[model samples]
Target: MLDYLKKSFARKKARRQFQEYSHTVSKFILKEEGEIAFANWNNPLVTPKVISQEEVNFFKKFIPKGALCIDIGTNIGDTTVPMALAAGKTGTTIGFDPNPHVYKILEENVKLNRDKTNIAPFPYAITKDEGEFYYHSSEASFGNGGISNEIVSDQGAFQLPQKITGINLEKFLEKNYRALLPKLSFIKVDVEGADKEVIGSIGNLLTKYKPVLVAECFTRATSEERAELYNIVADLDYTLYYFSDFDENAEIIKLEGPKDMNRWKTFNFYAIANAE
Candidate 1:
């Protein structure tokens, strides 16, 4: 009975917040003057829409204009907008997410940033192979971006289930954009706990393409898994950088300190090519 009450309270709260957000977005649309004013500005899951100006500047500096950037686990495309903005009118930003509910929001977000010349939103997951996989429902949290079947819960807040088609990063890149391979300049991967698999699957692409990578390596990754990740990155001859603090609110920082990024933390790094 207690648990039931708690869930009921949670549902009520979620509905209230969603209503408030709906009002805010409606007002903002009415006040604004643009071609795409009807486009929604809120994330599918209410992950706080707070991004630091400094972080935006960092992305703009690291990601080149006219370069192709692939964002894995793009959730509802919040990051895609800023990335597309950073890439400017000439660049292409591809956002991939398999969750059907979130993919709808991702599509909406792409429309929101329609002024951004070349942004493509794909409803797919970049994994080891082409197959069907289950996606956990996002419970209005940014960390709930994407979850595998093992971590999904039916009775809990996450109740949505999605069967997604996966793609091997290397093979997908070759098949879809073989001629434009050289233009692939940066990649931001954050596929929940499947980071290792995603990184491993794209090993050849990283080594061959040499694109700058900013991956979200949050907790839940084992030390050995982290080591494996490091080795793979090292094999590509790429240098790593770590963010100072990583939390829902903690901004992604580009460290300028003396400590070598490899030794600091298991996660949070900007792996740049040796030549660049």
Candidate 2:
């Protein structure tokens, strides 16, 4: 009973800290091999240097110059900026984020690096179809935002449901990026728990471009949903590799099959197209 009370107190204290940080905004210079200017509220734990340096290194090694890339769930341009830089001036990095509040930050961050990187920010959510949906934007944790049809965080003290525009990936790509499809080199997805939906919507694009795909899978998805995601990649003739970190030397464990992911609650993975 005494230990339980201590644990409860600790949780309450952590919650208080989260609330405090949520209302605070600050700017910092994020430095890894390169430097990025960043600002954030409610996300003291995130910075370009810490979470994305390894990813940047990995992209530098794999993504060719002048490549076209996509960044889904581009929160404040942390990953987008690095990818844009890696893509060089001739290349373009398109980013999507539906949360209005955070999308503003994403825009600002993109502008902050405008002179150095080629990044375009889109204020729309990627879904299986075009429509409007309620976005659950969490106040305490900014990254927990998700569409009404998808799973979102329930741990926050407060959340606002804001109606946002959703874009069908296939249709949008056809209309806007069709000409660049051949140059598409990489696609990064981190749409909370809705990765499967996004991947499903872009089946044709994946088949045509066969860009390297990096996606985040949440443990909250059902076993069937997980299987569907794995099958989708497999059907595309892509080999699966689990991403252990952003480090250039991060472990890239190849999975023989989808069952290999059953035990992890959340994991990042890479899907590389098999040679034709």
Candidate 3:
């Protein structure tokens, strides 16, 4: 164990030798898991270990092999990669994140699996409205956030701003991936506070395909807004499930409706369509 740790640290130190990005990117590889590149490697969202068998299996429950999946707010492809694997090589996993720093790494991670996993990443936010989108991040895309309408922030300090292109995923998919709509099996959304907006925008898809959904109920949002977020899914006839943290063995809690949120403070959850 001691020798393995020493060699592991040595390899990590060696990999950091060529951080060729303004945000200082690093490459980390977990023996069999392949390579993962990230700006803030410590951020749980980009860590390689987060894609354990349990995580992949969790997604496997909702995602069939050769089915289509989507990951919104996919910072640097950690969750995206797992979903891709669960969907198998023939399937496609699409990830969207407007933060360039992390999106670059997201692209790199996708390339690492070019021969094995089918992942297509886009640098557009899944917004409902039509407007100029601006992404501001103090932590260089390591944490949660969205390409919001405003460029300025009252949150204070180091909010590096970048203009981002926005698109409605439902409309975009209807136009581009129209034929693949039947294969749409899952949609994961964790855009900090804009989870509701993304959920609301895909109302048509949710009603038509009724794919399993994973979304977050952010603490920053008002109770009314949170209720509406769940209501959107509930009204679409999907059962809701949540886990407080992304533990490998995390057990999901089922929510009958928005009121169940008061008892379990988990921000993230899975929503499956109800049977006919």
Instruction: Tell me model 1's lDDT, rounded to 2 decimals.
Output: 0.63
* Local accuracy of candidate 3 as per-residue lDDT tens digits, 199-229: 8899889889989898887766776877888
Off by over 4 Å in 1: 1-45, 51-53, 137-159, 245-267
Candidate 1 vs candidate 3: the TM-score winner is 3
Model 1 agreement with the true structure over 1-276: per-residue lDDT tens digits: 999887677565654342223312221221122222223434333534543344444667667778788889887665676677667668888888876655676676666645644678887889776887666543542225454545556423453444667877777778887776788888888877576678878888888889888775656566666666666676677766676532223445454432333344456677887885
TM-score of 1: 0.73
**Can you tell me which runs of candidate 2 are displaced by over 4 Å?**
1-34, 42-53, 137-142, 149-161
- Model 2 is weakest, by summed lDDT over 10 consecutive residues, at 17-26
lDDT value, candidate 3, whole model: 0.73
Tell me each candidate's RMSD, in Å, in order. Answer: 6.4, 4.8, 6.0
**Per-residue lDDT for 114 in model 1?**
57
157-200 per-residue lDDT for model 2 (tens digits): 44544568999877887799888878999999998878888888
User: What's the candidate order when arranged by decreasing TM-score?
Assistant: 2, 3, 1
Q: What's the TM-score of each model vs. the native? A: 0.73, 0.81, 0.80
**Stretches > 4 Å off in candidate 3:** 1-49, 138-143, 244-249
Better of 2 and 3 by TM-score: 2
